[model samples]
Structure formats: C-alpha cells, structure tokens
Target: MVIETLPARLDPEEAKRVRQERLERIGSWLLPLLIMLFAIWLWDRICVWNEIPRYILPRPHVVAQTLYTDAALLFGSLLVTLKITFLSLLLAVIGGVGLAVLFTQSKWVEMSFFPFAIVLQVTPIVAIFPLINIYVDNQTAKLLLCSWIVAFFPILSNTTLGLNSVDRNLRDLFRLNGATRWQKLRHLRLPAAMPYFLGGLKIAGGLSLIGAVVAEFVAGSSGQSSGLASRIIEAGYRLNAPRLFAALILISLTGILIFLVLSLVSHLLLRRWHESALKQER
Candidate 1:
C-alpha cells in the first residue's frame, strides 16, 4: 500500500505574509485613527495649558478616568438607552412590515397613507415628543412611541417598494403556478424584498438611537427612570465636565457599535446571495 501524506498546511513564510497583509489593511486605517486621537490629546493639552476651568473643558485622560470610576452608572444608563432603542425598533419592524403588506394589497390604502408616512419622516421628533409624553403618561412609553415613529417609515417604504416592485415576469410565473397571494408574498416578494428590508433596518437602527436621545432630551427631565441623555444633562448642570465628556464618549461609542453590528448583520445575510455583497471578492 502506498502511503500518501496530506498536503502541508500554510508555511511560516506564507502565514507571515498573510499576517502582514492583514496588518497592512489595518495599518491603512491607522493614520486617520491616530489623527483623531492626537487631535483629542492636543485639545485636552491646550485646554489644560490655557488654565481652562474643568467646567469649560476637561482633559481626555480625566474624562477617561471618570468613566472608569463611574462605570456602573454609565453602563446602567447605556442599558436603558439600548432597551428603548431595540424595543422600539422591534415594534417598528413589525408594524412597518404589516403596513407595507396592507399597502401592497390595496392601492387606495397606499394612496391614503403614503403621504402621511412621508410627513412623519420629515417632521422633527422634537416637535411631537411633548404631545406623545402627554398622551402616554409614562416617559419610557413616550420614548418608545417616538422611536417607533421615527424608525417605522423606512421599513414601510422599503418593504412596500420591494413587494410591489417585483418583475412582471416573476409575477406572471407565480400566477401561472396557481400561487395564492400569500404564497406569492412569502416565496417571491419577501426574498426579493430582503435587501430593501435590510437597507431600511440600517437606517432605522440609527434613527432609533436618535429618537431615544431626542425623547429623553424633551421629556426625561421629570422622570424617575432616565436614559443616558439624563446622565449627560446631569453632568452638564453640575459642571462636571469630565463626566459629561465621558457620557458623550459613551454615546458616540454606542452609535458606532450599533452601526457596526447592523453592518455585520447585513453582510451575513446578504453575502451568499446579493450581488452587492458578492462584488467585494470580485
């Protein structure tokens, strides 16, 4: 019997090259990242050298230290913000998709409600938050309602466009196959609408965060339970510049993480099927 050895794995040199390529990709991003860090550092240094009061501007290191010291409080506030955002987003997706389906089935309904959707999109959340607060009576409920209003439109618009925008040939084929409306929706429209839905989801994620912050800004001052916006407001009122800065940093990081997570989800869902995702390797 002939003994056949398996092919050797990547050699050290090849592995090193692969590592270098990854580092190079990361390195390409380094300059801009460093520039941002240096700018922050320089700003802090300048503020300190100018004898700027802590209330005016705190050092970056001081802000970072403050964050470390108050990690529990900061984290709790962050969790509250995240809860409102995600719950609102869940409601938006369900309601939006349901409305989209209704609109797709009824031209009259589409004509009646489409303009209202556009109106909602254009209206500032700040303008309506107080009304929602009054009607809802609970700060968290008002916040959720505001966030849902902000987030639902994108999903509705995108999914409706997708469902109704299917190719005529595909529709004809489905009809020829004796497919019911629901079957056509499930098999043909939904798969076709996934990209659009994902696009809307990305937009809605950011909008949800914005809605939460805006709602908190408008109505949370009197509430017992509050989100990160309250922490930011409290820090500012107390003239605790470092704490304020830390809260701001946390908010920024939260937004970035949401975007990153949504991006990854979009990639995972689309990579195998969508041309836009597959074009990367090409």
Candidate 2:
C-alpha cells in the first residue's frame, strides 16, 4: 500500500496581516529615532545660544570633533573596557549559576550562602575596591574582581529563584516519569529558568560596565591596561570638557550596544517556544 502526505497550508490573509504588523513596528521605531535626532539638534542649538564654554560644557560639534580626532585611541580603550566587562560577566555567570544550583539542591546551603550574596549586592563596591586592590596585588585582577562582584549577585539571585520556581505539578510529573534529581534539573528546571537567567544577564551586562568603570576610578588605573573610564577621568582632570563628554558618549553607546546584543540573543534563544518572549510577536 502507498501512503500520501500533505503539505502544510498557510492563509494568505494571515501572511499579509503579519507583514503589516511588522511594518507598523518598524515605523514605530523610525519615528522615535527621528524624534531623538531632532531633540539632539535642539539641544545643540540651545547650548550654542548659551555660549557654553568648552571648559564647562563643550558644543556638541566640538565633542564630535574630539571623538573623531581621537577615534583610534577611544576605540582601543573601549575594547579594553569591553574585554573586562565580558570576562567579568562570564565569570559571574559561571559562579552564579553554580551557586544557584547548589542553593536549590540544599536548603541548608541556601540559608547559609544566600545572605552573603545579599550582602555582596548591598555593600557598595566603592567601599570594597580598596580592600580588593590591597588583597589582589594586581591592579587588573582587582578591577575584574570588583566588576565580578557587581555582576554576580543578580545572576545568583535570579537563577536561584528560577530554579526553585518550577511548578510542583511539573516536579511531580518528572518524579512519576522515574526521573532522577539530575534529570529533572537538566530537563525541566533549566529550561524553565532561561527567561529569568536572561533577565539577570541583561541587568548584569550594564552592572559589569558600571563596575569596571567604578573600579578603575577607585584604583586610579589610567596608564597601561586602562579602559575608557580612565580616559574620561584623564579628560576631566585636564579640563577638556568636550573630550570628557565624548568619552561619556562612547560609554553610553557601548552600554546600549551591549544591551541590544544581549536582547537579540535572548530573543533568538527564546522566541521559538517561550511564551514570555514570543507572546507579543504572536
């Protein structure tokens, strides 16, 4: 006997609806971008009228000139800052995820270590920077530690919440399937936790950048292996307001880029099957 298989069918009207929706979304973004550009222009005009001194608040054009003239230096230092942020984030994810798993596995461990994680989160990194620098002996390592401390708590707390927030029914189902604790964790909890994990990652990305900048400020590491934070400090000290603003702009742009990249990654990972990511799109 021969068997026949049919191709899936799609409604033309549904396809057209989706296309229109996408176009509407694009238009929404375009309008906001245009508005932002107009606002920048208006701000520039006001600054020009006020005759703001370059030493105080430089003209946007002057800041742009400084940025373009020192593009190479700025870009190179940006890479250093990016590297430290990325590395610290990687370490934070590993440490946080591992600890979260441990906490979920043992109530005693959760009770013991969770408070310390809270402490780490609440304690100002500025206050600890001196201690960390003294103990680490390496300036670079000290900066990384400071960044890691800033980034780690979110991942730990969020992941722990995600891991434990699994539905009781699901847990029972897994147990009914003769699933071991490890199997349940691998198959059920981890997938359930991805949304929370990504949320924490987004927050952690920004925090990592802040931590790196703050640590550099505290450590006064502005010579070799220094990042954009040091450049901003140097510019400020030299009374070059335009250069300082340019550096600040670069840092802000870098942060936005990091956030956008991570958001894209999260969308790619979760858009297919996850309700939280795909609900609006659907």
Candidate 3:
C-alpha cells in the first residue's frame, strides 16, 4: 500500500524564519528611531531644567521653528549645495570612468597618471581650495573643481580594479571564441566591473557633498549665492545655534539620502545576478 502526500501548506520552519527576518528588519529601523527620540527628549529636558539660552542650546522645537521660519533661505542654500554636489558627482563619473577606460587599455597610461589622481585625492580640499580660488576666476567653477577633485579618485580606482578583475579563464574563452577586444570588453569586462563602478559611485556621492561643503567653508562665499556651509558659518558668527543645528541637519539628511539612493541603485542593478545582492538564509 502507498501513502498519499499531504496538501501544500506553509512550512513551519520556513514561516518561522521569514517572521524572524521581518522582525529583525523592523527592529533595525525602530531601534535607532527610538534612540533618537530619547536623545531629543534628553536634550529638551536639559535645556528646560537648566534654563539654557536659545542661542547656546535651543530646545529641539526652536531648531524646528528655525527650519520652518527660514525655509526659503535654507532651502535655497541647500539647492545651491545640492547643485554643486550633483554636478561634481556627474563630472567625477565622467572623468573617472573615461580615465579608467584608458588605464585598462594601456598599463603605461595607468602608471603615468594614477599617481596624479592619488595626489589630488590625498591633498585635503581645504589646502587646494586656496589655489583653486586664486586660479579659477568663476566661483561656481572653483567649487565644482574642488568637489570633483575629491570625488574623482574613487571611481577611477574602483573601475580600474574592476576592469582588470576579469577572470583569466573567461578572457581565454572569449579569445578562443574569436571575440574582438571591444566585444570582450562590452560582454565580459563591463559586467564584471559594474559592481565596482557602483561601489565607487556610492563613495563618490558622499565625498562630492563633503567637498562642496568644505570648499564653501574655505571660500566663505556668502549672500544670495551661499551654500549651507556658509549658512553654518554665518550662524556661528551670529551665535544662532538653532539655525546652525538646522543647517547641519540638512547636510546630514542630504548625505544619508544620497547614500540610500545609491544603495538602492546598486541593489536594483545587482539583485538579479550578483552575489552581493543575494539573500543567504542560514
């Protein structure tokens, strides 16, 4: 006699695992949010209990109010800062990938120019901004150049490493198949290099924002054309701590948004095929 198989239903172990993973993900976000709320409560309590002046350490509400009251000014400044950040990131991607391609084609080119890239990266933007300010007549150009300098090297290095990281066996197979150099690059090398390029892009995004802010700080460009860094400096001079905190919050949020967007991009592109995006269950 043969036994009949049971009807399909949820596996107890699999369901338990899924629920545990969901809780962990939710807790990951919730825990930090709860901590932040507690910190804010602590800050508000300290200010109220000690009668701390608004100029010294305004309550959280004051910072929120400042953000709302100066929304036009702060947002406008943020737009300028964002403009610089995005443009620099774009230029870095172009220049970095272009040079990395050249490097892949010729070892001599990599050896010749890679050191210069490293120099630009290692030299603090604060130091370079003075020279850039003097040499670059256009203020916007100076800011863009300063930002691009910091963002450039990561993309260049990562892409170069990716391009060269192709498996030897894959290259040999392509060669055996009579694949041309361009074909090998398009079909074999580029895909292998994508994760590295995306990784570089994510790093470059944050660096570009930092470079823009640092350049603005050093340049001390103010008035209508000023970026968030200028607002921060102006707030410091006026002893407007709430406004300073608000500006800082904007900058931090901008950075976090950039990173999240880049991370989403990486996940979307890689989820179908890459090991980095794959979910491994124990």
Candidate 4:
C-alpha cells in the first residue's frame, strides 16, 4: 500500500505572533521619534510666542546652530571626557573582578574589606573629590580615581552574588569528579557570574561618565585641554545658554551610546545559553 503525506503549514497563532512582533518593533522606534519632534515643535512655538530672549531660553534651532558652530571644539572636549569615563570603567572592571575573585576564595578577606567597599559606595564622590584633589597632583589621575570610585562597587557586589549563586548540583558534580578548586571555578562559577557582571558593567558605564563630569566640575581647571564638563562650566559662567544646552546634549548622547554598546556586548556574549538574553517563545 502507498502512503500519502501532506505539506506542513505554519500555525495561525505563530503567524499572528510574528506580525505583531514586527509592528511592535516598528512602533517602538516610530513613536518615540514622533513624540520628540512634537516636543521640539511645541518648544519652538512657545519660545516664538513668548518672545523669550536667546540668552534665557534659546530656540531649538539656536541650539542646533550652536552645536554645529562649535562641533569641532565640543567634540574635542568630548574625547577628553570619554577618555576619563572609559579609563575609569576599565580600571573598575579589573579591580572589581579581581577583588570579587579574591573574596570568593577567602571569606575572612571578604568580611574584612567589604565594609570599606560600602564606604566608598556610600560616600558621595563630590565630598571625596576635595580630599582626592588635595593629594593627587595629576589632574587626569584625580578624574580617573573619582570615576573609578563611582563605578567600582556595582561590579564587585553583582559579581559576588553571581559567584555564590551557581547551581548546587553542578558544584556537587564537580566535587564528585574530583575537580580542583581552580578547575571548578574556571568551569562553573565564572560562567554563572557572566550575566551579573555584564549587568553591573552597564550601570558602571553611566556612573563613570557622571563621576568624570563631577570631577571635572570640581577640578575647574581651565585651559586648551578642558573636558566637556569644563565647557559646560565655562558656558554657565558666561551665561551662554545655547552652548550649555549643546554640551548637555553631547553628554546625554554619550551616556546613551555607552549603554547601548555595553548592552550589545552582553547580548552577544550570552545569547547562546543564558535565559536573560533569550527571547521568550510561544
């Protein structure tokens, strides 16, 4: 006897879900863009109607003009700020992960120094910057230290949590297999802690930028090599509203870029195995 087979088809619900996802993604981008344009339009209309002075409330166009006119100078300052932010972030990762590993290795050491980490986290960078500036003669080093202070605690705490949260079963399996301490750590704990580390990294990136700005403001060092923060301060002192707004826009955009880049790195690293990076499926 001959057997007959028919073609398989996509379930109706699956098709509906696919279309819905596409539309949602499109709306997510389009709606925010539309709202931003509308707000800008309203701002321009209000400024025009109220006859506000440019020095007090410059129109969006005026800010755009300022951004373009000063792009070269502003971007150069932005590079300086970025250097401090990224250098801080890099150092925080190295120190945080190294300390976290040490803590995982020895409970006595963790108990001893964990309080100091908290103290650093809780003390406002502004309050600390004054003392740091007193001792740290190199201006760049001062900014780096302040930014690192702001970024360090998150990575250390999150990584510690992740290291301790590994599957008990897998740990037992490692023990049963007679795995050495280094082997178990390399094969099990570090992998489990990756997601937490990335999450902390995202938070650290933004905080580092904020710390860099705060340190710059505190330093108030003026010259050809001043960072964006210095430009903001200079604009404020000169009552240059347009320039101030432009500088703020650059900082905000930089923070956004840093966040997106870190998020992409996390997704790329975790997408194959981690549930946090996986999309839920019906």
Candidate 5:
C-alpha cells in the first residue's frame, strides 16, 4: 500500500516564539550600532555648530583619522596594556580558583586568608602603589601586580560563593552515593560554580584593563614600552586631543571586546544546561 504523508506543521505559538527570538537577536546587534552612529553624528554636528577646535574635542572623524594615522604607535601601546591585562587576569583566575577550592575544603583556612584577600580588594591600588614602587622596582611587575590586585577579588569571592552555594539536597545525595571529595568537586561543585566564575571573570576582565591603565598612570614611565595611559598623558601635555581620543577609543574598544569574548565563553559553556545561559520560552 502506498501512503502519502503530509508535512508536519509547526504550532502557531511556536512559530510566533521563533519569530520573536529572531527579531530580538537582530535588534540586539542593530540597536547598539544605530545608537553609536547617531551619537557620532550628533557629536560632529555639535563641533561644527560651536566651531570647537580639534584641540579640545576633535570630531569623531578626526579621531578616526588619527587612529588610522597613528595606528602603529597606538597599537603598540595597546599591545603593552593588553599584555598586562591578560597576564593579570590569568593570574587572578589561577589564584582565585585555587584559593576558592581551598576555602571549600577548609573553613579555617578561609577565615585565616580570606580577610587578607578582602584587604587587598578594598584597599585602593593607588594607596598601595607607592609601597609597590618602593619594593618592586620593575615597571612591568608593578603594572602586573596592580592589575592582578584589582582583578583578583571578584573571582575569589564569586567562586567561593558558588562553591558554598551548592544545594544541600544534591550534596547529601552525592554523599549518600559514597562520592569522594574529589569526585564531588569534579562532578558537582565545579559545575555549579561555573556560572559564578564566569560572571566574576567578566568583571575581572574590565577591572584588569582599568588596573593596567591606572598603574601606567601611576608609573608615569615614558618610552616605547609604556601602555595607552602613557599616550593619554603625553597627549594631554602636548594638547593633542586627537591622539588622546584615539587612545581612549582603543581602550574602550578593548574593554568592549574583552567583555564580548568573555560573555561568549560564558554562554557557550552554560547554554547546554545552566539556567542563566539557557533560552527561556517566554
């Protein structure tokens, strides 16, 4: 017998839901770009209307031009800043995750050490930079230490919270199953802490950049190896607003890119099962 099968139809609600999701996805990218263009246009118009000199506030196009013209110098400084930011973030992740794991293992250790971490976090880098400079003579090491101090606390605190936030029932179940500490950590706590760790990492990424820039500002060390902050300072001294704006743009773009990359990592890692990254059927 030959049978003809008709094509299945999607549910009306599901079709509407899919369309909404698509629109939302498109809007997410489109809206920010539109707003940015509008802002740039307004800025250019304001500069033209007021006859403002480029020395004070260069038009966006002028800044763009400067970026193109000074790409080599700007990018070199960017590379230096990026190196410190990334290195600090890496160290923060290692130290924070390791310490958090240790905290989970023992309350006494956490009580003894967590306060020092808190002190480091709460104390302004500027306040401690003098001491750092006095003791650590290397410019690069100072930048790394300052950035690491700024980035370290978020990861440590967030990961600690996540590790301790495990569901009692689930933990009891694991215990009932005769799971070892390592097994429980590997299978349960780590997975549970993933979201928190990612959240902290996103914050730390921006903080690392800020710390690197601030450290550079404090160091005030001139030369080719200096970061974007040095360029900003030099531009200020020379009254070269365009170059300063260009440097600022690079820093802003760098921060945005770091955030986007970390967010993508978080979404990719969590989307499979975690609620925060999962798409809701609203």
Candidate 6:
C-alpha cells in the first residue's frame, strides 16, 4: 500500500491561530521594550526642551553614565540590601510555612494566632519599624526583622488557604482508605498547596526587597555598608540627580529580577503536574 502524504497547507483557522500565537509571543516582549524606549526618549526631550538643569532631572544617558561611574559604590550597597532581602525571605518562609502547618493540624491554634498575623499584615511597616528599630540594636538585625515582617503574612495566609482547600471527596476517600493525618498531609495537602505556596513566594520576594529599601529609608543608616536606599538619600542631599536616578533604576531592576526568578522557580516546580503551569491547548 502507498503511504498517505500529510497535507502541505494547514486549515485556514489553524494557520490564523498559529500566526496569532507567533505575534503574541513576539509582541509580549517587543512591545514593552518599544514603549520603554519611547518613554525614555520622551523624558530626554522634555528635559532638553525645558532647559532643565542636571540637578533637577538628569537625562537618561547621564543617569546611565552615572550608573557606570558609580558601579563600585552602588553595587556594594546593592549587596547589602540583597543580603537583608534574602535573609528576611528565608526566615519568612520558614516561619510562615511552619505556622501554616501547625494551623492545619489544629483549629484551636489557628484561631488563637491567625488574628495576630492579620494585625501585622494590616498595620503599615512604617508604623512598625520604629518598634523594630528601638528593640533591635544591630543595623542588620533591624533590617532583617522589618523585611521579615513585611514578607511573612502572605506566605502564611496563602499556604493555609491552599492546605485547607482540599476537595471534600478526596478527604473522604483518604479517610475511607484509613489514611492517617500524616499520610494525607504529605501525599495530598502539601502537593495541592504547592501552587499557592509558589504564588506567595513570588509576592514575598518582591515585598522583601521593598521592605529592605523602606526599612533603610526609615532607619536612615549611613556608612560604607549601607544600601541603595542610603545612596538615594545621599544623592538627594547633594542634588546628585543622575546618581539618584541610577539608584532608583537599580532598585527597580532588583525587584524585577526577584519577581522573574521566583516566577521561573514556580514554573519549574509546577510544570510537570500542576494545572496552572501546564500548557493550555488554547
């Protein structure tokens, strides 16, 4: 028998869908880049047209040049901030997840303590920093505590929600099969909670960075080991607009990088089995 040949041309709808997917894939990144460049060009033109002094609004190129020239100082500060951020995130994860597990095991414990978590979350970090600053003598400890407070609640709440959200049918089935609490937790709840934990991780990552910077601003610490926030303050004091812009750019970039890294981690962890990470036919 002769082998059947596949069609050379795709159906019209299939061809249209393929083209759309290609366009979307390209446009997702390209459009944002184009818009960002346009915004920068507009900013430069506005500064030039208004005859603004460098002390007021430095041109993008000047800010870029400042980034290059001040790389040593800025990068060092970045390291300090990053250290606080990462340490805080690590602590938050440990505390949050541990607490969530306890809450899942005991409703009494959850009711007794969850309100305190809510209080911490609702209260602004600025309001809480003074207490942290007063109680914590070491500069790094102060920063770490502040960041941890900011990052902790999301993980606790999200993971708790996920753990509690197991299907009733599944629960009954496990019970019928004589599964113990530990078995259900390990085989069912934790796996189901993975997506929620990952989502919270992404949020906590950015919040940890923000908390570190904000804590720096509030503490107003100054020295060789101070963070980008201190550099921003110093730049403002000296009317170093270019340097201030550069510092701001670094903070923005750091937040973006944290989010991207967390998102990648989430995707990698969930891609094989989680519905959210699975590729959709559509």
TM-score of each: 0.89, 0.88, 0.93, 0.93, 0.91, 0.94
Tens digits of lDDT, candidate 2, 1-282: 222543365489777886898999899999999998898798788788998778997877888999999899888889988888999999999999999999999999999989999998999999987788668877678889999999999999999999999999999999899998899889999999998999899999999999888888887753565688888888888998887888899999989998999999999999888776765533
Candidate 6: minimum summed lDDT over ten consecutive residues — where? 1-10
Give the per-residue lDDT of model 1 (tens digit) for 1-282. Answer: 233663478788877876997998898999789999899989988997898887889878888899999999998999999999999999999999999999988899999999999998899889987677678877788889998999999999999998888989999999999999899989999889888988998899888988888788887677575688899888888998888888888888988888889889988999888876774330
Q: For model 2, what is the error of residue 190's alpha carbon versus the real structure, in angstroms, after optimal superposition?
A: 1.1
Q: How much lDDT does candidate 6 score?
A: 0.92
Candidate 1 residue pairs that clash:
none
Q: Assess each prediction's global lDDT (C-alpha) against the native.
A: 0.87, 0.88, 0.92, 0.92, 0.93, 0.92
Looking at candidate 3, the ten consecutive residues that score lowest on lDDT are 1-10
lDDT of 1: 0.87
**How high is the lDDT of residue 263 in model 6?**
96
- Output the worst ten-in-a-row residue range by lDDT, candidate 4: 1-10
Better of 2 and 6 by lDDT: 6
Query: Could you tell me which residue pairs clash in candidate 3?
Result: none
Error of 2 at 54 (Å): 1.7
TM-score (C-alpha, index-matched) for candidate 1: 0.89
TM-score of 2: 0.88
lDDT (tens digit, per residue) of candidate 4 on 1-282: 222553366588867776899999999999999999999999999999999998888999999999999999899999999999999999999999989989898889999999999998999999988899789888899999999999988999999888889999999999999999999789999999999999999999999999899989988853433899999989988999999999999999999999999999999999999989988754
Q: Which ten contiguous residues of candidate 5 have the minimum total lDDT? A: 1-10
Please say which candidate is ahead in TM-score: 2 or 4.
4
RMSD (Å) per prediction: 4.8, 4.9, 4.1, 4.2, 4.1, 3.3
**Stretches > 4 Å off in candidate 3:** 1-18, 221-224
